[model samples]
Target: MLAYRHLFHAGNFADVFKHALLTRLLIALGKKDKPFFYLDTHAGIGRYDLNHEWAQKLAEHRDGIARLWERTDIPGPLEPYMACVRAENAGGRLRWYPGSPRIARAFLRPGDRAELTELNRDDANALGKLFDGDRQVHVHLMDGYQALKAFLPPKERRGLVLIDSSFDRAREFARLTDALATAHRRWASGVYALWYPLMDGTAMHAFERGVVATGIRRILKLELSVLPEGWNESLRGCGLLLVNPPYGLEDEARKMLPWLWRTLSEERTGGTEVRWVVPE
Candidate 1:
């Protein structure tokens, strides 16, 4: 998994779906006066240049952010997310893409703090340089799952943890579920967002059952598929599981995901889904 680099897939449809929801979570955390902490496990380079060779290889952004770059009818709930993307591309050219760390840092208040961990030394070094002089953001070169055990129950006692793993290893789904259970026990009140690709039905169901077995409540599951059933050429969809989601996010997702599916789906074949995997 160490060789897995996100640059090849930066700004893809999955990125769009994940980051759009991420911005909403960060916004909700900021509504209260108290400062909160943010932990990004598997943080890639803080930002990406779409023109880079690695990014240009797949040119995934063409079907992702590029589709929304000039659109005027973007839904209101997505404005904050689009603004973050726009900020990375000045002069009206969509050449840059902000990764989760950059997007999260944008929402961090003066008093808020963030900790980003990346196992890849090169990626962690790049991430560290991205926030070199910033006192509020810290970068760590460590395994993301281990980071949960190290940084859980953050001092602020209020924040969000984004576990956006690469899913490059075997048994990653089980690993995510176990890590979630552990982290929840340590910080039950903290908001946790776990992202995963839509694999075969059996694996997906097993993952859902695993999470349910954890007995964690209030978990929201949002998924978007741009390819129709039976289309398996590549990753057709991805899902985000939100633990302790902020109020109204379920409704916001109901509104936001369908619009995304409409705009991003291929031949209008696939669709969106927003539902609670576990209720309070």
Candidate 2:
């Protein structure tokens, strides 16, 4: 059934990797002023209060973002990522944590439009209010995976789509892998970012193979493991699979991964890799 609350782990390691990519993507889409569109599938509760009982219970952020909070001059490639976190965590301490939807909304401007979809009714309603007064952003209470099929090649014809889900339900992968084939077919030039876990690196390979089989021509995969290769013998790592990723992002990941691995290493074999099956 795949039912999990993001509040428990808002700014954990996953957010670090996912948002790092998203920050770079928004920067790319922001390069031009053609009114690019931003779409977020699987939007969670726009804002998160780490102090909340749910969030405080785990306090994973203490180890994740907190570990990298200070330390200025972060890496060249990681600057944007750090910038976004700092912007979100402004106001002295980390009181509120913005999820994908909230972070996407921050980039929206007068002409820019943001479309967010959340399958969970409670989350959808909350997501809507997150941007209630903002006419530039629209929130839909529906399945993000389904939205992939409905909203593509947005009106502007130039934009970024973020597919970020907890994958609480394994079916999400099935739907996401299929939707990529369909969405890319409709808007092959559109930029799409797919966030995934690395518990089982092998399974992720299969998913990427399926995506490559679609022959999208341009796809990049970035994987990061908190534990070393032999650290957790029974556990798998985590990674993000990107479609139509911006130019030079793979190299960016290449540098940022090592820094992250060093800071969050749980095993001796833990490391990072940035590679693409298609030409950039």
Candidate 3:
């Protein structure tokens, strides 16, 4: 959706969570000599300009990454995530933010392929133009979910799929559930990450319970943000459901969350929880 250009939100709290996890997972995927597929559904412009109107208004990063960036004294768990953000900034003045494609590009090694998809025409065109001369990445204008289904079990047999939808459609949650179920059925052993806002606690709980009921094992949840005290309040956090997360992520979350809670949250204090939804 053009309404959500990502330029305005880049390096904000949500991006901090999503990109940090993404960078870490891709890093883990690089461990093996075998090649892997990195799929980004709902990829936005490959990169963003903080000077843009949207970004300049709130400059939300001032409260998010801006707080963490200045400090070299990061906790161990967040070291990898912090490093990812820093490298993307190139120790520069954090004027730009790297989207999924740019973040994926940063870690791509020889033989590793990245497939980025954006349904929005404007964004798709921008994505294409963003890396017009690059050969390692493929920008697809296709529906990301369908494209993901078609590209399952990539030739390399190891892959990661990132589904970060805008959830503009009422049926988006259902569609996401069905799509993830289908993708999981297609590549049971692959790593899958799904992001969703904290729209409604009851609704989200029901959704998660249903997914776990499907018998997908090792479903780990990484949640950040504190619940508002009043019964009625805007959803303040986002979550990542990792279907086949790499080893050490749970441990990493354990150590990383406290520092993030202290730094990124606007409440001065917040909540961060990482645990298995389904027992190992």
Candidate 4:
């Protein structure tokens, strides 16, 4: 849905989960001396002002990044992520938040390149202006799935693709599965990180089955829910499905998810999962 604006939920628990893991993925890619490409499909406005009326409406960040904002006990795996968040709020006041595009740009070495896509005209235009003069970054006003066909198999042969779609439309899960299957076939070696909301059990099972049917291997499934399963709420939790995940990601997630759940869970009811949907 083009009407979906990420600012309303920026810095929420889901953002914490996705952005933290996203930082780890970028870090893993940077481990290699060789330059890597980063494709951010569904890139929102690169930066969000937490004090903006939209963000203040829900004050969601209070439960997400705000909880960890002044903390000194964050695990080692989370340092890079925290550093980025802190960079956005230099005055010690949580005034701004960096979306994936800004976060990805933070880790870009001299040779590294980043491509961000957003379907919303306003967001796409904002994203373009955010990185306007930087030759290393490219912003496109296009559908994320279409971006896969257009930019996959990056010339560098090394990169990570983040598919974060607003699940407001019906059958989005099916569309993501099909598009991913096609993209994987096009560039099987590329690292892909997909974010989705945790839905009903039956729908979740069907989503899993669809991905399984793609016969994609080495899929790492990570999920964190603030509420217990079947919780009747707006959003129980969210998950990140990684394909061809870098080697230490699973272990890193084990540490990060539990800590995030401990800090962000209002009722302390929901849990975390770190497992292989399809092992190598």
Residues 1-280 of candidate 4: C-alpha lDDT, one tens digit per residue: 4778989999999999999999999999999999999999899998999999999998888988999998989999999999999998889888999999999999999999999999999999999999999999999999999999999889999999999998989999999999899999999999999999999999999999999999999999999999888887567899999999999999999988999999999779889999899999
lDDT minimum window of 10 residues, candidate 2: 228-237
What tens digits encode model 1's per-residue C-alpha lDDT throughout 22-52?
9999999999999999999989998999999
- Candidate 3 residue lDDT tens string, 1-280: 4466677677778787788778788888998899888889889897777778888887866766778777978776567666666666775777677787888887789899988999888889999998897887989888878976888867888979999987767777778888888888888888999998776667777878777777788889998874443324544777888988998878877777677777776666457878788866
Model 1: lDDT of residue 72: 98
In candidate 3, which residue pairs clash?
A: none
Candidate with the greatest lDDT versus the true structure: 1
The lDDT values for all models are 0.95, 0.78, 0.80, 0.93
Say which prediction, candidate 2 or candidate 4, comes out ahead on lDDT: 4
lDDT-based ranking:
1, 4, 3, 2
Q: Per-residue error at 136 for model 4, in Å?
A: 0.4
Give each prediction's root-mean-square deviation over alpha carbons.
0.8, 2.3, 2.0, 0.9
Candidate 1 positional error at 255, Å? 0.8
Candidates 2 and 3, the one with greater TM-score = 3
After aligning candidate 2 to the native by TM-score, how far in Å is the CA of 113 from where it should be?
0.8
lDDT of 2 by residue, 168-270 (tens): 7656667778888888888888888888766555666677777777778777778777765544452335677777777767677777888887766655456
Residue runs of model 1 more than 4 Å from their true location after superposition: none
